[model samples]
Target: MALRTYDEYIESLKAMRPNIYKFDELIEDVTTHPATRNTVVGHGHSFKLSSEPEYKDIFTTTSHLTDEPISRYLSVIQNREDMWANSRLKRRMFQLSGTCTGGRCVGWTSLNSMYATTYDIDQELGTDYHQRLRAWLKDAQRRDITIAGALTDPKGDRTKTPSQQDDPDMNLRIIERRKDGIVVRGAKVMICGVAAANEIFILPGSAYREADKDYALSFVIPRDIENLTIVETRHPSDKREHEEGFDIPVSEGGITQAYLFFEDVFIPNERVFMAGEYKFTKQAVFNFISAYRAAIGGCVAGQGDIKIGAAMLVARANGLHTKVFKDKIIQMQINNETTFGIGIAAAALGKEHPSGTWLCDMTLANVNKVHVATLPYETSRLAQDIAGGIGETGCMPSWKDFQSSRYGHLIEKYLKASSSAESRTRAARLVEWLTIGAGVPGCMHGGGSPDGAKLMIRAFGDLESKVEIARRLAGISEEIPEPGGR
Candidate 1:
């Protein structure tokens, strides 16, 4: 079967025994553990969506290679419409989950990037990397497997190149190339959804020169492979999961980050898509980021929808849903719509690559990312302003306290405002979750930090044209170009 049911996906995850750690303790069953179970459930929603009639068109697509129906998460973008559908699917998934859906989108992004870059590499150097990747992707589609994309390396010294570093292993590299395969040793930090994935796709996070050839590699490996360890990173309010009667609204659908270590892990020759192709490193990374950042614009705007809804709820509960607060809500809508508009523009303006995969417009994608880095914060600030004192009051009384026979009446009396105490308390919890807990920081640096988007904007934007326009307007030059021309 090309597509798997939700139950089948969960069962597949249960069959593989991965090495995972949380707080120095081994997680015997990631699918059942509190720290990871929600993420798996969130991921499973994608499978469910694909099977449903309403979402089938967006979530399932025909595989170009095999001519079978496969999840869109595993299919390559074949045209501009596919790109637009991809962004809309991401936004819908985020709105449904109320958090990032682990790493499914990351896998989709990396697959398209590899398809485009490897085709170029093979055409130029007469290599078979594209064919190898195509074979692997077809198998992955048939199995409907979840693949986590690992991009960031644990660079020990930011100022030093991989070769210049005192410890060469700090950046993942080929320590030994055997006849059948290669041995890789190093670590990747800020990895998303490794514990729940069936496999991981590794790519160089930054561009590299010839001297960094060893570090400029890309490949795929199974999560349960030997010599690989995954440690889940701790986040703020993570302990709330263990506390009874502490209903965290935002975290109901959990997300994850981890540190992945590969110590002399052997990757078979067939799985090695790119090995020592340093010159193509930049293209691979840029291709991935351009698409991923556009996705961020859509998903983050979905999150902005959540923030705006919470703000409106709080204002109504506080008996302050007047023109002033209504205007704030409108402003939040403006920011949210702006980001979503950019994402659609990026997708609509995408161009096809030689490899038959569509690539997003770089300038618009960077602009989308830059807006994502800043607009969400302002949305959160407006949410807090509308939330008023309740936003700063911290978490509400525990469910236990609200249920206690002795204190229940007192809480019900004091907490009640323009509405029931339960409504106000839950609204406050949601605001806290979106503003200070996980939502704000995630928006500010999810795809990449704001400064990173700024650098990309500078690189992709055409400043020379703007200068020419200014000079021509001032009659400094006789020539004036046509509209939309340089």
Candidate 2:
């Protein structure tokens, strides 16, 4: 696939078969449908930026398979610089689009995760999964299509494993293994950006035992594949999605999560990277999270940067100098850099796999994930605190109400602050959206939960070594017992 221009990107999406739905309505055209259009526009900007002289370096990379330039979204991360660039690109995307571009980022990380995983599987089992992945990625780079990733399943019981669940379809599983392909059934819930994606990369939701082999599946397929149905999930900004004007900040860009129901959807063998490979599921998921969580630091930092700007803008609109909130703004900056710095540290401490793919340090990456889960919300709170009531409360009149012919003049006159009523309204709306509306990304639980990340942190922690060092410093050889006296 050749590199697509912004127009080409729109056209490409326009060509896909309509399979997305929102509230029981069939979306015939994702390019213009309000429910899907913003996401498409947000992802489309990546294509536009890839060709720009200023952003080309971070947006495009040489495809290892084809020796041709491809969207960084379509390239594999092979080194520290590549990983750093990935983080930078994610940050820039949020800086510009002001939301999650899951149509690209998660899918990009999925393919990269599989790049290392498939290699390891093939080496140990003499499987052809790696070769197939390389071939698929080469074709993908050629097509340069947007691919979304799906990992969350409509798991019925949090405590039960897939095989133990009352309903087997609780987790996506291989229903039938045909000579040509495999048939899958079940659903991936709360997936991001299916409407804007041409194809989707699916991975096992979690590690599985042999009994759950059917659930240990990985593959890619067309988003509009036969027997597949997509339902756009509801969010806090549902009513304003179609609203025109500054009521919805970054109107051309948006966030969407979807639920995908697959009814015996067939994925061809070449597109199947893992099938019934229960043994490799842990590493596969582990690999994906390290990259995803690390890069999410940049995602939140970029949006955090916007939070800083919006707070300042609101202060300006109220005729107050930004320096008045210097301490709060500085705290926001600290939160942003802490998350970003931890991600960079993870990338820097990584080691390359035998497959030639680089993996972020698990401990540092998970720690950053914890930071992403908590710090951004604090930054947002600070932004809202500095914004005063109008920006934080969402009490402003509708953009339409303000523009009405009968009372437009009166509304404008009273709404005016130190600045023009229009400017103040727009700035307040921007702040409201960033802190509470669609502009918010999956900061707290996007890739995974903070609790989950902490579990990983505990897994990777070396507490015994630290205890030994402490003992040496204190010159105490005697064992110290805990409250439980283990």
Candidate 3:
């Protein structure tokens, strides 16, 4: 079968009838629920883009396995060009949506990470996990399924490893190992788009020691599988979606995240990609981080574009588009381009792993993420500065209020700026959503925190080369210690 259309994608989700709960109430239909419907719409847009002629090259790619056109989200990154293409595709999707991509691209990164790791494990241990994953990838491509990448575990204690924790269920673990399959029991927090996704791809969030074998597991399962529950997380201004108005500008096509609970969920052997291979968990995580961070840099830069554009629009509407505001806009552009350029560099510098999957340059990828962690906030600050008090004000007159006979003329007269009252209001709302609402926190910690990126940067940097350069420049002798001498 060919790639599914937008309507087909929606129907496919409706057919799943995932076990989702929001605000302590069971959502009967996620396709129509206010909290999750927008996420489905956001993901549906990607499917639409794949079928358009203009976006065909960016959003669709030929599958190496089936030799058929498949969503780029399911394509393997075979070379540096593919890596660069992944970043460009993510940026284009973000720019079009003006918000998150609803976690549609996560499965692609997970596939690439798992593909490389499984192959390496097989080469070392003579396991057949690589072939198993390849078969699944082919089917996923043919079906064009949306997959949610679940990585973060709800750690009960920050200082303790999974096995060290007093509560064994704090981190996702294999509670029972049967001959036919394994039963996993735990919870994953902040799982983006899980309620709308067709499948969930699980990966270890941290490296595990030998003793933490049960926690060092990875697998995939249907989102609607039994013994699983999804609890949606509330974001700032989320309730605005249920309200009647043009007041909630960003909610038009928003995103959703949730907590995923696995209550002894059964995973057949075919779905189990990694189990008890503790040493490979670290490599799997690093691969995912490199791909995820590079993609995020591009996505965040695209969002920065929207923020800068909105800031300029707001400044113009308020008659504040002067030299000061123009300079601030330029600063925002600089930060955005810096992040976008690093993502491109990381992709261009990618190297092919022995498993034939491409991996981005780790140092540059981490650098890209670190910049994204702070630059978006800086962009938002400049935007709010130009927007004045309007950006900070949360409450605005509803659409009904503007249309009322008693307040229509009053609002029209007072709310008017350099532009129409409606346009000005929309610009302010957009800036508010991009800056203070949902956007900032997502940028700060979406892939990983800035501190985590710094650690990876330190781990991957060429410190020895820098020391040698300094020694040669300063005419200092290089001291070498004898192997046996302390």
Name the best candidate (by lDDT): 2
List the candidates' TM-scores in order. 0.94, 0.97, 0.96
Residue pair clashes in candidate 1: none
Q: Write the per-residue lDDT of candidate 3 for residues 264-358, one digit (tens) a residue.
A: 99999999999899999999999998888887877888888888888888878887645667788889989989888898889888899988898
Enumerate clash totals for all models, in the order shown: 0, 2, 0
- Please give, for residues 178-275, the per-residue lDDT of candidate 2 as tens digits: 99889999998888888889899998888889999999989999888989999998876776534476744476578889999998899999999999
Task: Show where candidate 1 strays beyond 4 Å.
Answer: 241-252, 322-324, 393-395, 477-486
What lDDT does the true structure give each of the candidates? 0.82, 0.89, 0.83
RMSD of each: 3.4, 1.6, 2.2
lDDT tens string, model 1, 225-260?
899988989866675544344454454565788899
- By descending TM-score, how would the candidates be arranged? 2, 3, 1
Q: How accurate is candidate 3 locally (lDDT)?
A: 0.83
> TM-score: which candidate is best?
2
Point out where model 3 deviates above 4 Å: 241-244, 247-249, 322-324, 478-486
In order of lDDT, best first, we have 2, 3, 1
| Candidate 2 residue pairs that clash | 1-142, 1-143
